[model samples]
Target: MRPARALIDLDALRHNYRLARRLGGGKALAVIKADAYGHGAVRCAQALEGEADGFAVAFLEEALALREAGIAAPILLLEGVLAADELPLVAEHDLWMVVHAPWQVEALARATLPRPLDVWLKLDSGMHRVGIDAEAYATTWQRLRALPQVGGLVKMTHFSRADEPDHERTREQIDTFAAVTAGLPGETSLCNSPALLAWPQARGDWARAGLMLYGASPFAHGHAAGAQLQPVMTLESQVIAVRDLPAGEPVGYGGTFVAPRPTRVGVVAMGYADGYPQFAATGTPVAIDGRPGRLIGRVSMDMLTVDLTDHPDAGVGSRVELWGRQVAATEVVARSQTSAYRLLCGVKRVPLVSVGG
Candidate 1:
């Protein structure tokens, strides 16, 4: 097989985690969900174990996967208990759960366990997601507090748009969240990756960050490249074939790129199947032998051709970075009409091997 792969800079992972702590100025829970958002949960959790206070995932299976990998640190399930029968495994595994709905509360309130389960209550300050309303927030907190089946309860909520620092909606969310649990009990978690990095006010007793630790900017407007944040995952492939096409020769599917002039086209061993965005525009950037290059056709399921006529040194077996230190994944995501979060997590078949663990 080719060396096409995603090299993860784990040292940068620690730095980004610490960045969250530094910016938020509070306890931080590294949100390592979606397999650490495609960084591999076991691998990411190990890198983040000692540095972060804990890790939060979408549900129980992800937490259990980490446990299977011998990760003993705290892991919180952001989605909470998926079933009442699994509470034993949760308690046995020492995994914390988030209670978002009334049934989850009632399930815990009625279950008889060896002791109370560690849980966090989800508050719907805004976003209008799965969280309970303010009225329910107060009542459920009190009710869950009284239940011996539930252990320490933490307050948690998701941010709608912390990426856009100038957006007033985030301000409204912070204010509403503060108002909801102003005088209530236990620590609170409001900040995600963007909030942890930008909104100092959103930092609560605890914060759950998902993206920044991966070194990709969640900000849709611009990035703080001056802050010294480094990219974590570098996805690179190589040219498997190269051909000099005559003028007007179309390239790839549907002839998306009909060369205006004779051109040198190279097919790189990456496509949507390899996690490269299928919708990557014709002019989307790629890097060949450390030189800037551009994809010239539709991103196929297995391979995509890039226009490499400008690089005299470029040839078959040459290195090509889809996105990384050389080609920013954020920039590609922008050109692909998608977000880095989706692009990073959507990668398949490409192994994420650690570069600087």
Candidate 2:
């Protein structure tokens, strides 16, 4: 069996969800899209179903998978139906959907369903992504309201820069959403992980918990709220081999790192194939035998090399933490030049074992 595995602390996941709700002062939908950002959707949903206000996924298939797995909580389809043909299934499965573009609203107006679908009308609101333009937001809401197939409607928008905390752009986006949807009589969902953590004023009737639910801070810097998140997944492995190299010898592909002195390098059985970032630089952080260490070479597909010279007793079979507990995923993500969401979602080829649900 492979030595690498992801340890998912379901207790931490539940803790983060509760934190999001408390921070936003409203109901929170645990955003479990992309297989709970690759933490295994079925298992994650099972772990969270008991107390999650509901779960949110990117599309219909993900929602359907959860339903099949017996997740009876309200599930919102963040991207809505990809094609109009999916509307029937969306209706049949009792899925709520984000009706963003004109075609989705048009499809809703035309469809005759077994039941009215709960729809979230998404406003463009500075994200300039898949949403109805702000100028047309109210009219679109009215249009969806008139549809017999539409049941409850919620107003929603995504933040483009809430992670910055001090950025005026987030304020502008929030104002835009507020002004345009003024007088609209429906619940609002504006805060994602970052906004929920940083911008209290922007939190709406509902919050969407995504990256933070996995226990990684959404902000590049620290915050009181971000400090509350507990890491959920710990990617761990064992040292498979070690090399004693003299000063100036190059290491790994491209010889990106040259030994500055006599170096003891420990090889780890984890890499890009296991969802470790391939471009994570030589100085990236890792924890070997519960002590801090630094990666020392270009990451390989199935292995990476870490400097172990500081730990005289560490060698083959020493425990290595890629990210979790002793080594924060945020630190590794910052050093890798990637976001925590991407880092968490990129994990693959490693078995996931759960504890503390």
Stretches of model 2 off by over 4 angstroms after superposition = none
Task: Tell me the tens digit of each residue's lDDT in model 2 across 89-180.
Answer: 99888899998899988888888799999999999999987899988999999988988899999999998999999999999999999899
Best by TM-score: 2
Off by over 4 Å in 1: 225-227
Candidate 2, lDDT over the whole model: 0.92
How do the predictions measure up, each by TM-score? 0.97, 0.98
Put down candidate 1 lDDT per residue, 202-294, tens digits, no spaces.
Answer: 778887778888888887757563145678889998999999999988998899889988899999999898888988998899899998999
Q: What is the lDDT for 163 in model 2?
A: 92
Which number leads on lDDT?
2
Model 1 per-residue lDDT at 52? 83
